[model samples]
Target: MNEHPFAEFIKILGKGKKGSRPLTQDEAYRAMTMIMNDQVEPIQLGAFMMLMRVKEETPEELAGFVAAARESFHHDTQTISADLDWSSYAGKRRHLPWFLLASLLLAENGIRVFMHGAEGHTEGRIYTRNVLAILGINAATSIDQAARQLQENNFSYLSLEHICPKLYDMINLRPMMGLRSPVHTLVRLLNPFDAAYSIQGIFHPSYRQVHQKAALLLQQPHMAVLKGEGGETERNPDMDCLVQSVHYDELSEENWPAIFERRHIKPEELNPQQLAQLWRGEFSDEYAEATVIGTAAIALKLLGKADNQQQAEALAQSYWNARDKERFST
Candidate 1:
């Protein structure tokens, strides 16, 4: 009987505790390439993903997966360029996505930001795609559309379903699998547009180092990872935020102090329209405004527009203060 082509990859991960090991960069690349190409059977795919999820993916594995996923893109992403690659996969459950406003503010100030994420994978959370729609912003459906939008608006969001349908399907398997597969981790590193700077947010504090190491392995020029609010890349202004970053071959960490002395209460309900209203200066929420500015401040420092935390916060505040309130008005 002929052996299954993808079985070896599964066996490598499924071996008993002593024998099981993480795949090498090359092996991971091939395995993911096979998965993305639909060459692996459903059962095999399930086994492989669960094994990876159990062991937790190594930096090399994540780097390889990201490389394979980027290659699977339908368009040549080299043609696209952006200042920042912002990933919004976690979906906000505790608060409105203040990070969306942060990204838009950066874009308004001439920072070319390319954002990507997925939706409906988890219930009861506010995903980026839905919030963008409510703000009258359309998510880019293709690499070309993302490029055009970036060129015109300095910002564009490409959803995971459009960026890589195979991975999108894998992410949706979360509910069925009863656990998030490594796809959630790898997708955050897929800087499809090859942006100079990338920012990632994770719900778990431990994943901060995992993401930092992976970015280093991928040779990402500059990147930052934080335990953000609701696992989306929005900073929690009331809590001191620790940011792990990779710069060239060097790995570094920074601690940004909490912006508020007391933590504000979470909203009873999330209103997407409030995102725009805040941007237009028509709404006042101390916590929400602090969140937007604090989030943008970290990005500003990452982008090299500010040399220190103080400068970053000041610059972000200036951008927010100067934003054209009517830009999104209908």
Candidate 2:
């Protein structure tokens, strides 16, 4: 039994209390050791998550948390070979998961993609890997294999289960705790590609700065952080979606942050609620025209195929609309 984990755990919970000092990295590390090692009781674990959520976490504060969580796992994906690695893990409660489809399209267009998340949805399994399987992409059975496949095929996926045993262990708590901890944030920052073009969908707006700093730390090539359908998943709501991106254009590893685009399309263009209700039933309705256009535009800009987003956005709408119509007819 690790006493350090328990000691840090107490400090976190205690700090969240009305009268306690904010827990530091040293403190969080000590606590997480016990929780990750299963030395803490369920009651204590739940209390810790709730208190931390109530108090909120800072990027600096999470440095220790992420470092500890990362120490326990090692992954190597040899299959994905692309300039950009697409990743997102802010779990979605509703709406059709467009990320899966978007990833497939990205892969089809020669961009390597990777995605992972625990089981979500009422059925305990609305996840990206499942969708990929449905689409005929085989997930990597091992870390090295995933790396090999990425080098060979340009895309691969490793879930929390594969990358970090302790974080995967926390899936037990999502049901009981009813809220996510810092692990959700960790998933987005954990890079699969050593150096590649990157696009990210973040859960919170505040994470923009966090991700920028993280990109610098990781020494990534380019990264885009988007607000994403007003705090919802990558559903392309047809109502709105805001994309904030950071580009690492050259030898310098500095982050270039910008609001790539503001999403203000008509919800009527796509009956989002209806699409969610009809998933797995049939491939119909051709999806939301405006949102498809917008997403395609971003994709175009990220590829550097277009000089400006305005032109890229226009092209995305028209190109996707035409493609959707063709797919539906066939």
* lDDT by candidate, in order shown: 0.92, 0.55
Residue 247 lDDT, candidate 1, scale 0-100: 93
In candidate 1, list every pair of residues with a backbone clash: none
Candidate 1 TM-score, true structure as reference: 0.97
Give the per-residue Cα lDDT of candidate 1 at 323. Answer: 88
| TM-scores for all predictions | 0.97, 0.70
Candidate 2 regions off by >4 Å?
A: 1-5, 16-45, 76-82, 88-93, 121-125, 203-221, 229-237, 248-289, 299-305, 314-330
What are the candidates' C-alpha RMSDs? 1.1, 5.9
Model 2 poorest ten-residue lDDT run: 250-259
Model 2, position 234, has a per-residue lDDT of: 49
Error of 2 at 116 (Å): 2.4
Write one digit per residue (lDDT tens) for candidate 1, span 1-330. Answer: 999999999889988988888899999999999988889999999999999988898888998898898889887767887999999999988899999999999999999999999999998999998899999999998878889999999999999888888999999999999999999999999988888899999999989999999999899999999999999998999999999999999999999999889889898888889988888888899999999999999999999999999999999999989989998797
lDDT for model 2 comes to: 0.55
